[model samples]
Target: MPRSIRRRPGLAAALALLAAAAPAATAQQVVIYRCTDASGALTVQNDEPCPAGSREERAIIEPPPPMPVYVPQAPAPAPVTSRATQAAAATTPAVPERPEAPAPARIADADRLPPPPIFRCHTPGNDRYISEDAEPKPRCVPLQTVGINGDPSLGAGAACEWQYDRCERIPDGEACDGWRQRGREIESTWRYARGDARAPLQDAFARVSTILSDTTCGLPPG
Candidate 1:
């Protein structure tokens, strides 16, 4: 074994030289930093290139997270109606409502009803005014030979002859416009002449007479 080692001496020497060179080639160089802390203490360090008695600070760099993308939604459609067409709809007629009938007039007592014919006014040589309320006068000469008739001619020896003429066309009397009328005036005068001093009855009679005259005689020509 001694003789074999003596034979490999050159190789052994070269191996030793490689070992020494390997350490020199692989030796890491270090950079150092020095700084002062909040406590006013100085520090310096080696290894990761930091100040002594201080830890090396490494950068914690990281990429930002991805951003969010929004997608737009479409609005819902409106409903459609299947009604009548425009031209036919426009030409269609609207229905009319029927009118209501008027109520019938009510009649009171038949016995107290006024006569159909009313008195008229006309001037002749001798004039006679007759009222429906006239009574048989004790002094009125009821001549047995004389006669009274509804006529215009005043016959000889005639007791009474009725004359017919259109009553005066009084304003507001042609169409009843309340109480102001000629017939009412004449009635009020006659009521006073009869010595009936009852005011309310006289006024009532006047109003009724005015109404009746307008209803019956108002149809005379106009």
Candidate 2:
């Protein structure tokens, strides 16, 4: 017998066994339908036939597309510096720092003390010294230096007495007026005197007045 005729009975027997084993295959299958109603409203349904006045539209079953795969790109390479550029940077000179200023000189406390009174001797071998004592030395005339205490007449009592004697010798005239005028001028300048040296000037003016008074020279009006 031909091969087709011989396989017919076996194929029919296999189909019969499958139908018997799976009687509810049609009920288990899912079908989706798209339909339009009388009012032209479209509806989609699962496992239900279209209504009497509605038309059925074609439906299809499609496999879902594959999920996308994420690919990580390689990291960018680091920037490269040329040898010439690196050499230029290495050869650059750093700025020089400024020199600091020297500190100011400090003033000594001893330097601020008042100057000592100066004494001198007019004798050929006598040397000057700073002392307050004005006693006459042997063969030496004691003299107070000028501008030491702003009074040149200080420590010169002998000289002042000698001047007074000379004034006594002169008759009372323009000569006597000159001496009186000098005393008045000294007195006038003393009125405006100030500071620690002021007392010495005042004392000097008093000495001048006393000399004039002793010699009978006229005194200026107050």
Q: Each model's TM-score?
A: 0.19, 0.21
Pairs with backbone N, CA or C atoms under 3 Å apart (clashes), candidate 1: 44-51, 44-52, 45-51, 45-52
Model 1 bad stretches (over 4 Å): 1-115, 118-127, 133-196, 200-204, 207-214
lDDT of 2 by residue, 56-164 (tens): 8655433233345578999999789999988988998654222222233343443332222222223333433212223443433444455557777553343221111
Cα lDDT of model 1 by residue, 6-120, tens digit: 1223434544554444435343323333444444554443223444554344332122333445779898886654566556667887542222222322333332232233333
In model 2, the worst 10-residue window by lDDT is 160-169
Residue pairs in candidate 2 whose N, alpha carbon or C atoms collide under 3 angstroms: none
